[model samples]
Target: MDRQEDRHRLDLRLALADLVADTAACVRFFSRLPVPKLCSADDPARLPDFSQISRAIPLAGIVVAMPAGLLVLLLGLSQLPTLASGFLVVGMLAMVTGALHEDGLADVADGFFGGHTPERRLEIMKDSRIGAFGSIALIVSLGLKAVLIAALLDRYTPLEAMVILLGAESLGRTLIVWQWSTLPAARPDGLAHRFGVPISKTFKQACIFGAACLLPTLPVLPLPSLALGLILAPLAAHGVGMLAKARIGGFSGDVLGAVQQVGTLVFLAGCLAVA
Candidate 1:
């Protein structure tokens, strides 16, 4: 009876681990983890904790999205004769990310650029209606990415483009992590705080994730260009951090999403300009 009880306890522990892992897995993909019914939105007691979980979703988004980009490159190359398919593959991958960050990017552009005060800016961002600025920003950002990727496809071999896309996505998400670590939450209770909640990350974990992202990229470009990409990662993060601080007095979910989207685009633009 004692042995059976011990085994049952262990099984319960394992099940709990699986559940938490599911939550973390969702965070890794969505960058906004959803709260379970146990912590319903209506329950004020759950609000504080649920808020943190929600913000971690974008981190997960980066983790999952990078591989999707690589898959697109692989499939596109496999069907090289059908070049149009490559564009569709990439577009589909973007959709998989739910375009959460892209939407935030457009909203931020519209709100920040259109409004003169912080209150007005935040209000504009909160509005569901997209404005002229948001629409234009979205079109330009997406168009630039498509154009740049297509051009690279036309010129470079499949392997080279795949590496770049993967590297950019990983590096861009890493920037979000970096930004989250350094900045204060813009509001007393906003989505970004969950990620910004300071936790000690080990150097080993950093290197492991960094190596996973950068190693594949090393073979694509020359040593010098690879170095440039590495250098730009920190620089871009810092630039966005400054902008975010200046705008909202700190970072929010929108700012984090904007950082990832802008950082990825900036890296891609750099790759194209140099090549």
Candidate 2:
């Protein structure tokens, strides 16, 4: 019995360590944060194994957004104007993430609309220059997010608004994982293809973890609004998936980013509607 108990304890310790490592990997991948390498065997320069780290993506999302959320709380307590605070928090988030999703959204907009064929679209996406479509897309998405965040702040308390921001961020990253898992890579040599599609088990684990991350908002948000947001967010992501399927034949890294942006917007909008 003593030996069995010791082995069980060892197992639990190893599992906890692995979970921490995975979450760190995800944080490193998703944000520009200089998180230390937790697992020595894993290469620091290479892309994280999304298949394994995906289970912690939701938690990583919360971790990534924590700084911006804290900023919101601070600004709210300072009695800053809601609109200005909203823009500042949004800017902070963009800085934290190195504007990764925003860049992807811009690329997707430019590529999907600028070219007549998939080949040309892919070429356009690979180009570093931002065009008219990309510029317009960045303005609209960022503007909408700031406005919606301001609206939420105007209605809810600082703490509640912070929770809502965290929930939105978590849900957005969860949708990215979902789209990455469900859709095939659109290009053979693209980042999405190289990263590899996550298996069903990984996706299911992500959903479970993502749901757990959202639980904090239960007390802050109205139940009906929460449910509406939950239902609409995934649908918005699915619409992005469908558009990707039709436009480029499958998903790419840009598509995943687009998924995150659109899903987040829908979730926040739904919540704000009834708040």
Query: lDDT per prediction?
Result: 0.64, 0.89
Candidate 2 lDDT tens digits, 1-275 = 99999999989888877778878888888899888767644456767777777888888999999999999899888878899999999999999999999999999999999999988998898888999999999999999999988988899988989999999999999999898888878899876656656778888988898989899899999988998999999999999998888888888988888999999999999998885
Candidate 1's C-alpha lDDT?
0.64
Off by over 4 Å in 2: 39-46
For model 1, give the RMSD to the true fold. Answer: 6.3
User: What lDDT tens digits, residue by residue, belong to model 1 across residues 1-275?
Assistant: 99999999989877555435433544434533343443212331322332233233333444556555666567656655434544564476567667777888887888778888877887788888899999998888777777767766766776677667767776676666567667877777676444334233422333345457667666677776666666775687688788767876667767777887788777777666665
Please give the distance, in angstroms, between residue 133's alpha carbon in candidate 1 and its true position after superposition.
Answer: 1.5
lDDT, candidate 2, at 225: 92
* Candidate 1: residue 72 lDDT (0-100): 55
| Best candidate according to TM-score | 2
